[model samples]
Target: MLQDARSVASRSSQEAEIAGPASPEFIDFDRLLAAVRRQWRLVAVLGLIGLLLGIAYVMTAVPRYTASSNLLIDQGSNRIVDELSTSGGSIEDESGILSQVELLKSDQIGNKVIDALHLTSDESFMHSSVSLLRRVKLAVVSVVDISSWFRAPEEEADDEAEKRLTALALLGNDLDVARVGRSYVLSISYTSPDPVMAARVAQAFANAYLADQLDSKYEATRRASSWLQQRIDELRQKSLETDLAVQRFRAEKGLIAADGRLVSDQQLTELNSQLTLAQADVATARAKMDRIQSLLESGDTNSVVNDALASTVINELRTKYLDAAKRQAEISNRLGNDHAQAVRLRAEMENYKQLMFSELGRIAESYRSDLQVAQAREAAVQRSVADATSVSAGANETQVQLRELEREAETYRNLYQTFLQRYQEAVQQQSFPITEARVITDAQVPTAPSKPRKPLVLAISLFIGLAAGSALGAFREFRDRFFRTGDQVREELGLAYLGSVPHVKDKALAIPTQKAGTGTEASDRYLRANNAVARYVLDHPLSSFAETLRSAKIAADLAISHQKKIIGVISVLPSEGKSMISANLAELIASHGSSAILIDGDIRNPGLTRAVARHATAGLLEAVMDERPLKDCILVDPETKLALVPAVVKHRVPHTADLLSSVNMTTLLDEASNAFDYVVLDLPPLGPVVDVRAIAPRIDAFIFVVEWGKTARRVVRSTLAANPQIAEKTLGVILNKVDTEKMKLYRDFGSDEYYTSRYSSYYHQGK
Candidate 1:
């Protein structure tokens, strides 16, 4: 159990280190709700103030009437003049519509409206009523103008020009022009104090915009026409000059032509065709002549060469030769030996064959003649082709310059035609002027004013006020760093929370002196008058304050299993009522039939001695220094039998911490432990002194006291951390001097303090 308590203490120290002081790692909504409940009055008052201001503004503000006119940027209307006009005729896209919107808001349109309405001369339009917000702004500016005292004299100005400029500026300021969504429709709005004037101004702005568009288009078309006319005249002159140059160059170069082609070119084409035919004829003739010659050389007289020649004499001789050969063969068969008739027939066949050869030679000679004629024709045609080629080549060289001149003439002619057409279109467009913008809805007078929306303004003001109040409340909550309840003590120090002691007022701290009484009664009255808060536990044993001391006593008993326990009661800082708690706790324990001794161990500043035993001359300091008997220096209450060893400060003791840590102090506590059932020591605080740390080893357990809503959580955590032995030995923490009324504000739903009201009747206080 002791090890577990130590571990919890160690873990709590680690958490304190990690979270620092008031770290906002996690938000506790319950705490926030409690804070809101506590500070709701502040938030409500701020919001009410904001609401009143908003109401005053609404009541005093000037109302402005707004009139609207709608314009449709007709992109389709441009199609009527799109083909004829050279200028842009229609709004193309969103950007074009926005451009038109900007044009409507331009100073040119504003000037036109001002002139049309004669706004410069009209007092209502020239000097409208100023708004409350504007008045406040002007007042602030005048007050803050530091240069007004040293400013130089103003120069004379032109009134009329200034009025005109001011009117234009006012018109621009009150005008609102915007394109409606993705469409080519513009909404123009004007605001003024007068309804009729507002409508008139809005309508005038629309008229001015339309007129501007028409005038711009007309001017553009007129300029285009003039430019096109000038270009047409220049192009006509250029066209004539180029045409003349082409004719002069053609004639000078002698590039004569028949039809579309030159004469020399035609002649070359004809000669080339003739050369091709002549070459073909030559090939045919040579082939025939070669065929006949081959037949004659092979001696094949009876071959088809002779037949192909179609000679009557050669055919007759061939027939007669065949008959003779047939007759010779028959005669040789009849006459066995060399027959004379067969020999004679053979000689006749030979003669016929020779005649056929002679005929074939004649045919071959005719073929050779035909071949020579074809060769000569081919040669003549080739020579003519060569001559034509040379002539055509020269004509072609001259045609290059002719082609260049023709191209130049063609270009001028085409340009002249194009300019003439465009000139006609420009003229048409100039005569028929049209604008892409037109009014779709005329401006109408508004029934109500558009300024000073009361409900919305009030709501916004209230919201802002509430937000600011909430911020301030949260800051206050963050700045509240002191402990207010037992939960805070347990969570911050990792010690068990014993209980809370109710705050005792100064009147309650002083007991009324009783009129003369018995010896026992007189002694009790003296003790009570001297320290009523410490003696309060005896009179009100069942009260919450006394119950808290009992709880501490129980915790001390649980922490130390020894029969005699030396428990130290310590606090982080001085004046936290630890001395009173120590005295009360010892008295409460002694009243329970236990022998308890109360010792004022704070030798440096003996607050307990001053409150309880101020008349004592010797104390723990005297006993430790001079080895005095504990009984001689101790003061015992006659009623409760509680003993107290107060430190009597006769002089300044510089080494009180050393004296507390000395062997004599240890021996004194051991001797007291042997006599008393409980040894409670009222030690000095841990913040400004090290006496508690010096004697912490001798203490078996400690009860830490923290003044409610006074001692900082950081101070307690740091003091315990500086003295780990005290933190380890601490049995629990007791909250002293708690304001019970304010304590309810810090309690969450399930905490013990939340149920304090329900259990209040359980304890009674003696008056």
Candidate 2:
């Protein structure tokens, strides 16, 4: 049951080792900071280079000055003539102002300024300056004609048009036009090498714009006047022709007009008046005749009332008849029949009645004659009016034509007069000069150049440099694949990190020791003289470096189950200080009055044998192969009383793997296990040979040594991966040659705890 449990535990340990540690959380900021810190030197160098480049640009760049001129465009001002200026006032939108802006930027204004200032002939405005670098580039381009590979090459010929275009482009580049806020003011700026030229060009632009505006207005007025004059002359001739046509029509049709009345119209008016008078006369005469006839028919002379009644003859006749009737009536009453006087009176009364009848007949006959005459006149006058109306009707057509001609003449005359007045007004306006814009402020020579802002350029340069440096630093940090701290060793290799050994100032004197005797004194003197890093536990046990090794010793003791634990110190590659770890660990154990021995297992190299060379004549090779006693090969340090089996020999043994696994080597280990409390072997690096693999099963445990921030994690992992049998026996990992100051940059696994500022006081130089 116990065996099964042990097998299960072993499997669990292998699984845990293979699984490695959990992946660390991805803290981008921490990682970025660490990467920057790792390559801060490179960043600094690049930043310095950028600063120099900025300085050089500031020193070499050309200076330019800008001068501006302001103009007030009176958009709200009244025009010369309200009627002639048919163009509407400024709109509520920006279109009118924008159009003015475009006008200022147009080639017309630009060319005027250019000509006035003689800028077309000036080299500063027309020609571009070529730098040395540009000249070199041109030379190279002329020498090599590789452009043909991409397209058909053509000749670069210069012409008059090209020259004008180049000059125009240069002029445009130097000129700038902008509207000043929401006002009617426009700002015109010009840049040049000379401050005087800049100011002169700006002022010239404003003057040219004003002159052009005035000329435009004058030309418009002149054209309008010319057109109006032509139209007025034509209207005058039309008016004359219409008047002459009216007079000619009147003469041809024999129609005359007076006071707006025609000759035919007068004739019609006279005929109508005569006809009315004749009808009135006829009616009066007919009324008188009818009254007279009525009186005669009735035979009632006394009842008749007329103007004829007032006539003397008619009145006398009527009076006589009435007297005779009265006398006859009186006689008839007095005398009976056959009276002579009565008969005679009746005869006289009859005679009187007859006379009265005759007189009324006479008056009636006279009225009837007058009526006949008046009727005759009325008939004649009616015939005459009819005839006159016929003649007037004929003349009416000609009169209508004459009236139409008169109307046309009148209309032409009115139009002619209006055009003539308008033409005079246009002529007067043509002499008046006006402009839409005026200069508000004239440009002056500037005192300082506007370009080459030193501080801004330097600041930009510094920012660009820092960005580039940071990018490069990040790239370098990503490219490096080495372990930097104990956390990296534990996380990547899946091995327990025992401790870190801080890099001491002195190599050999890091361990403090008191002189024991001559022999020990001589060895110390040799170690101190040769400058080797060895035997720290026997010298200064209180030192951090010595304490770290002591911790490794304790780790090994706790890990190994064997009573006499055989611990082997091994590394993935060379130069990892495995031999140093072995020496220190053994010395640390022996310092506690424990029987400990260090073996030189690396026959090929024998680093420990060389470190203590005086007593390393006969080593483990002789003990294992030459049938010599193990005690004969044992070398003891007199001060620490540490036993060592060195590998110093005349020639290195071949097939070192076979030799380490031989029976003699095993018997020697077993015997040493019985005599010593701990056995430390300084084995060859696991990468270069199979010696460590051959000797791994014989040892109780293995101590893996890694160079801090130097050994790649893949190398250490691959070394153990290839030899799984030895990996299972690994006690823990030791990170040596740690830069305590640099280790503060890493925060994972609490790596800074052992190397922080508070721990610096615990580290001291061994006395």
Candidate 3:
């Protein structure tokens, strides 16, 4: 009992948290269990469907084949090799090889590969990877230029190479090329329907690069050979003259085998290039240097503009005007020349553009006009350089003119020195020319194609199908909650199951009339639905059903040995299950040989006529309204073990609950209770005209009927709550028509109860 109470409380608390205050009270646990039980079939079907779909997907999906090849990249010059150069070649190169990876992936090399592979004639190779993300960095600008192949179908040639190109263009989309680690190797992988083709394509790319590199080296050698030949002739004359001039100078200065300026010719060339760039940069950085130095020296908090005649604002405005003019001209081209709007825009654009260029020239000239300032900046730098110690010649420009001949001779002398070293290396290079880059391994034609995985597709398809089925099953459950489970009667209306009868299998439906032509044995099968429901209530009396009242009375009777309780029946809504409750309970209870009285309390709308007939000319309405004796109003039956009191209303002035709850009605019930084992009150449903509330407090127990999905929860709650006496003493709720297809869905155990219903029996037997 404690456990049951705890479970109920916990469940109610959970419901409150989930559904807030609007949640309907909990129904009978057995009914919910039954509903879930009934839906087990749907769950099974949907689950099976999901499983089958998954299996089907596993079967039909295409398998993708993969082919991979590698390329080793010699990323940068050997750093250690350069350090070990005791031969005195050049300074140590400090830059790492990682930065050189980007340079290798630059457009020049990529274009070379593209041209060599003839990708310009095949567009498919350009989109080597998906947009936004790639397996390797793209050398092209965001998009691969595949315009050559896709130019036009008409442009495609009829040759076999062109045909292969077409197919290659299509298939190349599956191929991916990227540089291998830091070595001089590259990895090319491709997925295709045919594995051999994938491998062949990858190998083709490698061969193409090798061929391109050889061609490039040969061209460089040719250019170098031509350049060296020209220098050889030019230096012949300069070499002889330099020797003569040196000898003459030597005689005049009385000097012997002296040092020459040719010692740093290479260094002088590098310094000259650097100086030229520095001069151009110096022009721009002077104003900046002055501003920065002034701030550093003066420690100023605010900036001071130095040039009063500065034309930056004007120059900037002019630049914008030029851009706008260009845009206007471009737009004008898209239109006609003689168009008035176009002509006006073009004129305005040209005028602005000219103004901008003129303004920039004017600005440059203004700066040049300040020659004194430029000279002053140059002089400061010159002073700084003068203080710096010199290691090379040509440090100052003032030492010139007569030194040109000397410079020429020195250049020739440096060339001779380089030739002497090259001559020595060339001898060794020929003897010990090692080939480290010979092919380590050759690629082979792959035996598989890597693509079209149908299994993955089928798997996804299966998931979609099962998900669709499961969703549909869930929706099917929401249509009806009444006949769905036994708990419905108890939880929804605070009623109880009387008792449930097993559904008879394949029983012939035969409605024996009042004449009893078929006998009682055959009739039992016809009325199995009503009997089964009554039996169900004996076990589970979750709510206020009269069965709950019966169970309570029966339990209370356990101590007393034999005590019966009188139960009053009512429903919040009219025509829900009040009539069924009276007839079925009376019939089922009497089947056990217990005497039961069915008092039809609805005087205005008597229900006994449709269910059973009793002798009654003047009934309870006349007795209650006119104060007739209790014995005369009630009728006793010996054959069925039941009694009936028909209302004499005949749709006349109704005898209300106020009349029934009077001392007269109470005295009548008291007498009947002593005479019968059980007394059933068929009370009026709650509505505007019925006085059900007035007589509620007078009942020993009451049964409320909620016709499954038909009765509104709000109507029942409101109407019941309005009658506190009835709500408190309510026996429980009974869900009627719970066997309707809608309600039967909640009946986990499939039964043929419908086939043997009284109506079914009556209809089938007649047919």
Candidate 4:
């Protein structure tokens, strides 16, 4: 049976460890909701404060009005001077629009606006109404000007210049310029306390921007015209000087030109053409002469002699010779040889051949004459070509310098014409300057203030306040290491949770004072009810405090089946109501007609002795050290018949642990066990002393009492873990001094405590 009880206790501990504290990996929504419920008051209070602050801000804040003006940067507006405009009368791209926006925001435009409006002298523009917050800030800065003391003095600026700069800076601060997305339009806005002033400032900004643009363009054109004039004069002078230099160079080098070409070059070209023709003529005449001479030398006169020298005469002579030869042959055939007529015919043929030869020789002589004339002409042309070549070569060498001078002169002349044209354009542009930017929509006074939005400010303030409150609440929850519910006792210490005991004050349980005439029985009753907490179980048996003790009794009975179970009431820290629990539990057990005894085991402090047996001088100490009988040291309860062996301390007892662990102490408990059905010992807390550990082995079971929301959970777990024997013998834990109403907020939906209110009527409280 003892082994079975031990096994059951061990299994309960193992289950408690398995169902220990919730893992950090997952969020427990029930716990979070419970925390929120507990901290709702704090959150509400902070949110209310934030709402009040927002109301104050809305009431005290200065109203600011914003007026806006729209200006269009027309790309074609400058087309009146398009021929002279350097920007080509067109905005190039997005960058150009952005540049215009920047220009509108520049100090140049800002100063112009300031000067035009005379903001430096206008009191409304120079000094606006300050808000309450700003006043407070200025006051703080004046009070905490520690750096000013250490700063070195500097020279002051001119009054006029300083005023101008200050006005410019103020204008810049109030001015807002932006390009209307992807378009050549600028939006200029100004904020001020006065609506009229805002409109005026906005209009001033637009006017100033347009005026500045016009002034910039006029200045650029004027400077360009002046520079062009100077450049034109220099170019004209240079043109005249270069022209003179070209003429002088040409005369010095004798480079005379004709029809856009040099005279020497033309002469060389004509001589080359004549030389080529003369060579061709010489070749033709030489070929004709050589052909006729070769024909004559070959001596073939009877063959058709075609010569340049009168071919008709040669043809006539040949015909005649042929006729004569025919006659000579006829006669020679008719008459005999040696006839005079036949001989005369043969002589005529000879005469015709000689005349053909003579004619051929004369033709060859004429060919030779033509050849000589062609050769002479070729020679004469060759000489003329050589002379022309010499002249052309000299001219080419001098032309290098001449060409350079010509090029310089041409460059100067071109520059002079170009500058003159540009000067004319610049003059035109200067005469008619135009600005591309113009106000399309003039600024109007705003009907309502633009800042200090009350609703939005209130909402944001509330949100921030709530967020802050939640952060603090979460920090409080994180630091809440104390036990609130019975579940905490079980989960943290791995022990069964019996129940919770209410914190019953003595005034609430008001015990009547004993009269002088009252008997011994009445006095004993008064003494028994002296401590309301210790005697609560007897007076109110139906209360939750009494019920918790009953549950502890049942747990003790189940854990230890001995005839006289020795149950030790223990706590991790002092003042956790362990003595009260021990006294009440013994009284509750004895009220059922079972004999029980309470022992004050804390020899060092002996709180139980002071509570119940205050008049007793000697009790457990006398029983253990003086060897007195336990019955003589015992005090019996008047109502429940519960016995108590109080530890009466006359002086400091240094070896309280040794006395508790001595054989005499064990014998004293043994005697109590034989005489009573149960022995309840109010042992010292496990944290402060070692008395509980020394007497743990002798005890049958222990009922751990923890102060509700007072004792740290880690202290209990660590104390129990340090003494495994005491932990194993522990029957269960009881949460003492619980605030039942507050505990309701900490309960989960499915927990036993969640339904505690439903069954609370079953338990009645006695005054």
TM-score of each: 0.67, 0.56, 0.40, 0.66
Global CA lDDT of candidate 4, please? 0.82
Among all candidates shown, the one with the greatest TM-score: 1
lDDT per residue (tens digit) for residues 1-767 in model 1:
45644644354446556867764648787777779887788888888888888888899878889999999987666543455455645568777778888888888888888889888899977767444555575568668977765666574346987788667767777889987888888999998989999999999999999899788778777777787788889999999999999889878877778898878888899999999999999999989888888888998865766345577888788889899988888998998428888888889989999988888888888989999999999999999999889988888888888888899999999989988987777776677688887899999999999877878989988998888788888787888899887667768777777889999875755563423436753443233336678778887888999888888887766667667889899998899999989988988999999998999988878888887777676778779999999887787776777888888889999998999999999999999999999999999899998888888888888888999888889988988888887888887788899998788888887677879999989888863
Checking candidate 2 for backbone clashes, the offending pairs are: 512-539
What is the lDDT of every predicted structure here?
A: 0.82, 0.76, 0.52, 0.82
Counting clashing residue pairs in each candidate, in order, gives 0, 1, 61, 0
Ranking the candidates on lDDT from highest down gives: 4, 1, 2, 3
Candidate 3: which stretches are off by over 4 Å?
1-40, 47-509, 512-565, 571-578, 588-595, 602-608, 614-638, 646-677, 684-691, 704-723, 732-767
lDDT of 2 by residue, 1-767 (tens): 22322332244346556968646766766656666666787888888888888999999988888999999877665465434545743323577777777887888987788679876567765544334564575568656867634653355445654456555555577788898998878899988778888899899989988998888778877877787778888998999999899878878887877887776778789888988998999999998888878888887757665755777886887788788778777877888535788788778877776777787788888888898999999999889888888888888766778778888999999988877887777777777767778899999999998877889888888778887998887776776678776556656766666778877545436344434546753543322212246765555677777877776777666665556788899998887888878887888888888899889899899877776644456779999999699987887766667788888668757889999999999999998889899989999999888899888778877778888878888888888778877777776777888887777766543344434567767766553
Report lDDT (Cα) of residue 158, candidate 2. 50
- The model with the greater TM-score, 1 or 4, is 1
Clashing pairs in 1: none
lDDT of 2 at 619: 77
TM-score result, candidate 3: 0.40
Worst 10 residues of 2 by lDDT: 1-10
lDDT of 4 by residue, 208-259 (tens): 8888878778887887778778888899999999999989988888888989
